[model samples]
Target: MQLVTSVNSHSIAVMLLTVLALFLFTREKIPLETSSLFIIVALTVGFTIFPYEYENKELHSIDFFSGFGHEALIAVCALMIAGQGLVRTGALEPVGRVLSKLWASSPKLSLLLTLIVGATLSAFVNNVPIVILLLPILTAVSIKTKTSASKVLMPMGFATLIGGMSTTIGTSTNLLVVSVAVDMGMRDFGMFDFIFPVLIAGSFAIVYLWLVVPYFIKERRAPLMDTSPRVFTAKLMITEESASKDQALNELILKTDGMMKVLRIHRNSNDMYVLPNSKTIIKAEDMLVVEDTPENLKSYEKILDAVLYSSLGAVDEEHPLLEEEQQIAEVIISQGSKLNNTTLSQSRFLQRHNLIALALHRSGKKTETVLKDIAEISLKIGDVLLIQGKNEHILELKQSRELLVLDATSDLTHTKQAPIAFFIMFGIVAVAALGILPIAISATLGVFLMFLTSCINWKDASNALNTQVILIVVASLALGGALLKTGAASYIAHLFVLSMDGMSTTFMLSGLMLLMAIMTNVVSNNAAAVIGTPIAIGIAQQLNLDPEPFVLAVLFGANMSYATPMAYKTNLLVMTAGGYTFGDFLKVGIPLTFIMWITFSWLLPLLYNI
Candidate 1:
């Protein structure tokens, strides 16, 4: 390949910084926020220290931070909040329930239907919540059928990625690519402009996921032994008239067959005791804060004849003064969640949400049995908290994006405002699709309606905005802008064209998609889309061909973030829920990636007659 000697030093430096940012993004040791901040700082300081003048216009340092308020970022955030409102109001839960019924009726038929439904819903709403909605249903199906969850989860996640490639508003990466392309003088793509190709390619992809991918993945058991493996810490109140009022703690242990661990004993408001010996005598009105899984906790309550409660107020629903419907559910802490790295006590979890956390489950890490210790430990992504509360309070928790409610048994029927939420979402898509309003404006207006209609509140809206996504999009924009300004994208494109000088247009398109597919798995898909969109355009310009096919290639390839858990947030979510390894993603994602890549590479050229 011949080198482009005419490329300026600033372009070379920007390219190097981009490479460094990619490195930082892929390193699990470095936090995403830190890497994004580093990249933004480097871009601003580098441009400020040595400003670059192109065509007598100097690129200002302030331009680097402009990405924070970029139109694409606004649209992405607004759409996210809107999607949250749909979930908050239970607008989409009915779909999940219907799908659940289908699964129960015919597991084999439902598997195909699952991929189709998942992909269809994902094309319209945010795919992450779509995965969140289906996750528990699939888990329940897996357990009921005595099948492994590992078989279905990865395929379902990949199916969403397929759907996300269909429309401009389908995925954040798609939005960024289209937004960048518009800024670079290409006609803006409509919401359904690219759907035909994606649907065509995605059909084959979905078939592979439904039929072949399950066999590729090994069957791994979900962490459910005699009930959910998630442990909760509940305080067992020894009532004055209970059967075991004066029983020895050792005797209770003997009765339970040594199955439970008594983490601590609370004698009174003024005194708390550590783990008691086998001979420790249990007294009336003493609070025994025990640590065990939910099933085992209830069993212990039955064995000791004590009432289990999270707060100090009431024992159960039968308490005459406190008559309300109660419920138990499992909620997982999401990545970029406000609850991440904070304790339940520190976050005032109970005081804020009015729900009591009975237990916490961290993947592969046994939580310390002491209630105080468990409360003090910082929560991480994928930590499942077994929580208990009134049905109302538990339903309210679903409004917030921080905690992913995994138990589908909760009554998530549409609220009075659910119809309004669905209408607003439909209106946003309609106006954008009809070209009556740009997506940014349509989505923004939809959010305002969500708040006005009481479908979503201030806290739910705020939590819906993901910090990592905001920062990464901003950083990707900054780098993309710099590349365009310095002609680095053009330089890279010229080199690529020269390297494949003798290759057919079909080979060139395949190569571009393949390159993007690899880069997306190793780095942020948003980054790949933002950066590759411009290069794809440049590659088209170099080849003296229309850029439409090339641009679509970039968009399709960037959304193929299926090869690793770290490639996308949805993948990370399923990793814990399904108990999958890194190899599992590679095993299924690699083939699926090639399937879509080859499909699109051949199909795009034919559609455009390139």
Candidate 2:
């Protein structure tokens, strides 16, 4: 391709190199960290070879490297730390639990609640953390309801993105675009300055994601929870709030919805075991020996508010057995192991190992046994056990002849601290939204409170900062500066206007939004925002129109990164958990991007009165 002669030869060269960098990124030839570093090095070298001269100020190497110390980068890191605090403390657990219950009863209501709650909270909180908190809950709901995680996950991710587009602190890309605009002599925008336009565009996108996205993508499922697995004994203790309270034995059995079977019941009041009759009634603290299936146990617990008790009765409803560090894993009983010839009660398994067995999976058709007979049933070869313990203990078992650890790894949420953590996040958002404090100051204060309240430790806070994303953001900032200084930004703006020579303002704005949406999906959205904001400002200046609308276009377009797995970080996270492939995103997201483009084009001009 012949370079445009209107731009300086050196500026054209930088644009070519930028295109080459984007090519390498999309091809997945290297990690994002490495690709980001390449941009920093190449920009530094290019500026050193041929510097930009404006009046007397020349673009220097140090200028190219200044993005490493940019304020936007620092603020983004702080937000990540605060979000991590919320995650570790289980701040969103209450919301997740309520939604999971709603989903268990009705998928339609669940989708509606997820969209409303996710969009509203995400408007104030960062979208990444919002998605992080909701991911596990949605996955559990999908498993419990026999729905595909892929069907649920993408909509949740998209809702987070739509909400992120509505506020300045909602995403790093939004912050970057506003920072760029302010640097170009535009006034600093407020947290809610662009909210109206976002809502207008977001409303259209949200409707599509909620009603239409699921039907397009086929169901993707997790293997371990399929119907072929065996069922095991779980001691369920009735709570005061149990839905099965004061119900007949037949009614209680019907309440499990085929997920569990009541084999025997023990009355806490009489300290006596009773064979349950059809007319027998449930009471608080009644212990039921139930057969739990992998697919239905979680749903049953949510429905009844019951607690899983241990065989020794050491743990009751008030005390939790699993520690914070303990996680659940599925392990298979290997041949010739001691467990092959022994029963759990006879073998004293707890005395032998640190991990405690939560449930068991045996092959072949499941057989029903009475509580006494089943609790003492001899184990056979190839039995799968869901064991709960720490990593060290699990690894030790892996080296021995006991069992083979399976691939799946999961942990229980610490829902006890949900209220306090959520209140802290709310305070941070309130102060920032009211302009009571700057976002940076407010977010940093929230992080300190998180530490003081024991929401998260120093180690976890540090780990929350993803170095790869940090490198990418800083590098993109530097590349943006390079484009602006070398006049390539102006060149690109002129090319856009020339392509739409006699068109109306609406067409030009739509062209710009379409360009940004496509580019953001190909590269980093923050990178797209950093480079496009200046060109957008140039377009507005040339046309003698309000620059606010143009700037808003760049902000919204950069967030249209739903079309590819590599388009956004949250997409990468949901991939394995949802069992999603690249093709899955294409099936649902590519067409949606065009819809967003057209929606934004039609709505933005009216919203901004452009």
Candidate 3:
């Protein structure tokens, strides 16, 4: 319980304090990025306000902010931009489409297929990028197959974690560990050094998911077609005296309180699957299957003097009137967004964004009722909005950080650039794998090429950087460096060695892995790996043991983010989207964590001959 007083110690203490504060306050409440920014500011101020001497020199102020320029930060940003290019160019969509087709066979088969694909992709690519590419496709498939999103999202998250450990470049943590090891005079790891253990672990995880996941998971099937809460189908008939007589069906629906989806319109005994121009005059006895609720339908019924008709029919026509002024884009509302708890009319979403909320996809259910007022609607995390607006207007709305568009339909025309984008990404990976260039440099260059090729516009490139992730990574790196420079890592390692002096190597390695697994649940996987790697290496050196096994233990433990949602970003991304409570993560994640822990502990010694 010695007080830390040196400049480095104070900086480290302040950083730890900031992280602790964030852990206490934003554990399950605030966005991770906001918490990270808060900690960054705290560290900066802690270092500036309480100046302390380190090795007879005042701690350099620049060190506190230097992480923003770190190679890892640059690499991550570049990777995100490159990922955006791949997405915009539609390079990954074909793979996604094929995966979707395979998933159509059955839920069990779908889970296994997606697990394999996610793990394989993650092993080669960054997990975040892999998740970004797969999430939207999974959402679409869930809707199509009428499966609950909760069933697949966690599995995907775990798969990505396992897959990321398969290669040195798969995750920043692996690279960081490699760098630390080489700095400590150990042999540098090859790209495939960790692949065997990871593959073994991933195989066990996949089997565990297939056998045990279904039993613990509750089936959250969407209500049957009739009882579906959103997007109800109703028939409307136009009469001679109706206000909609001479107006286009689109205009009438637009002017109504409810946003209407016209499936089919019958006119003069001619069934037109395609609605005429929005200006097409409505004639008497015209029948239309429009999307509206009982109350809204009553109001429209009174206005059109239309009789109600009932039939289970599909609407195949796209109304020209609606097409001109209306557009559909999916928007995911972020936590603490200004639009939270606001209704559509009140927030003036229609007025400000020139968009209407046609439907809301929360968890797996779709609610189609138009917001009477948007500002009055409480916004929660992971609320997916199916917004209708003009094409230009929809793009404008997407620029706001409060929303993320799920489908980039507007960018589909750029699909022809897919091959070029793939080659750029492949080249970057090849250079890095071959050691011709550091991953950070190669990735940055790849991003530049993406921009030059117009795979992703510059504006989108900036957005794709994920500022929060960048800031968090930078802050954590700074903190890790401070820990090492201050001898905090050595101090802690010595303390651990003293406490476990008589323990055998097997127990020591297991303890280190378990400790890392626990630390990751509270701090972050990167932070855990960076802080733990040096101690693990130190422990191995102290015991005259190979550092590879010890470092591998840290890597394996870092990827076991199953015990808590805060351990990983993908967990939080699905929190609101899947309507999962914090407890839900623990309920499912804890068992999985234990499973991996036991499996790794038993398998590691055998694999590496520890």
lDDT of each prediction vs. the true structure? 0.82, 0.71, 0.67
Q: Give the TM-score of candidate 2.
A: 0.70
lDDT agreement of model 2 with the native: 0.71
What would the per-residue lDDT of candidate 3 be over residues 501-563, giving only the tens digit for each residue?
Answer: 888778888899998888778777776776677778767666666778888889888778877
lDDT of predicted model 3: 0.67
Q: How many backbone clashes does candidate 3 have?
A: 19
Can you write out model 2's per-residue Cα lDDT over 1-610, one digit (the tens) per residue?
1123278876787788778777766765476778889888888887787777754677777787777667777767778877776666667656767776777688887887898789888887777667766765676566556667787788888788888888888898987898888888898788888787677767777788888888778887633344232343556788888877887878766766544667689899999988978788889989887655434554566667777765445344555333444445445443223565578778776446775555554543253222124436677544555565566676555433133343232222554555677888888888988889877788888888888888777876766777667888888888777777777877787788788999999999988888888998898888788888988987887777888889888888889888887788677555544657778887778877877788778877897787
Weakest lDDT window of 10 consecutive positions for candidate 2: 363-372
RMSD of 2: 15.5
Segments of candidate 1 deviating more than 4 angstroms: 1-5, 228-329, 348-373, 385-402, 408-411
True lDDT of residue 458, candidate 2 = 83
For each candidate, what TM-score against the reference?
0.83, 0.70, 0.73
Off by over 4 Å in 3: 1-58, 105-110, 136-149, 179-187, 222-292, 296-355, 358-372, 375-381, 386-414, 541-544, 575-583, 607-609
